[model samples]
Target: MSQYSILAAAVEHRLLEKNSEFITFLQPVSDREQALHWLQHYREHYKDAAHVCWAYIIGNTRQPQTQAFSDDGEPSGTAGKPMLHVLTERELGNCLAVVVRYFGGIKLGAGGLVRAYSAAVSQAAQQARLTLVSPQSLLRIAADFALEARIRQLLAQFDATLLDVQYQQGVALSVSLAAADLASFKLQLQELCAGAVSLTEPTA
Candidate 1:
């Protein structure tokens, strides 16, 4: 996957339009199933809500693999669409957004509902941390035990994550790092391990 932003944690924002209360929540999700799971949670939690509107974007936000939204019972195009607009405008993906409406008596006409829902999500996103997710490639390396420390240092410098390690005549390590960093990382590893290390992708 290409680099993109995702909510680092769940965020809640509140907005009042006329007498309606829009409680919006944004969460990071891996796929459609996870997004639906969270939508169901909010729906169950707010059984009395007038509407449980939701939207989600599953892959690269710019060129999404999947995207959907629902206005629930609100006026067509009033709630869910605007909420989704905010998310896409911000270039966020792998995230779910749910807006629970608590009717406050007065009805917010179509335009009003759109503005209210959009602002709710936009504000919540402002308050929440957005984390950039970079695509990672897995690599396995075998090196002498004596060179372990230097190898680890190189991995750290390249923002590589050590996933596993096995010890035999030497040490075999599984690591993951941003695909963009692979070339530079391999060069640096070559310099550090000289002719003593072997790096290869794990066999499927």
Candidate 2:
């Protein structure tokens, strides 16, 4: 897909159920490394907690290459899986959710554990602000000085963001644009410069 929903910023929610303390942390993560870093950070920070369950979905939602969850000490399929289900049901991408639990003497059965974990994540997600992000790619274009103004104008028209510009033999401009717009942008560039401008394959 060209666009997906992602957390606007990090958020947290705390819930108390049957004397058990549950804290949920939600944050946007672009890759596996970022997700792991946050998970480790929380684990260390809450080392005394009874359980630290976590689930993350990284990479494209359509075909996620990195997706994992850990139930920690909680019964399998009770903590991590339910938390992941909450994230997946919301169609969230590139995000991580961690639920830290502090035992409250009394024990919640397996069903209760699932509900608690899922509820924690659901509450945090509800409070979180989400932003729609379109897939973007880097495009490098080389043109003569005469075409610089025209190139800039075209980029603005296409809603492309200029990343860098170099004045060498000619002008080398690096720009970022939605992946969906790449083909049309290339066509417009060719027509505008009468095929004089050189375009490079886009990089993610």
Q: Candidate 2: lDDT over CA atoms?
A: 0.90
Ten consecutive residues with minimal summed lDDT in candidate 2? 58-67
Best by TM-score: 2
- Tens-digit lDDT track of model 1 for 68-101: 9999988999888988888898877788999998
Write one digit per residue (lDDT tens) for candidate 2, span 95-126.
89999999999889999999999999998999
What is the C-alpha local distance difference test score of candidate 1? 0.88
The 10 consecutive residues of candidate 1 with the worst lDDT sum are 195-204
Residue 88's lDDT in candidate 2: 83
Q: TM-score of every model?
A: 0.78, 0.91
Regions more than 4 Å wrong, model 1: 1-3, 58-60, 63-66, 104-107, 143-150, 168-170, 191-197, 202-204
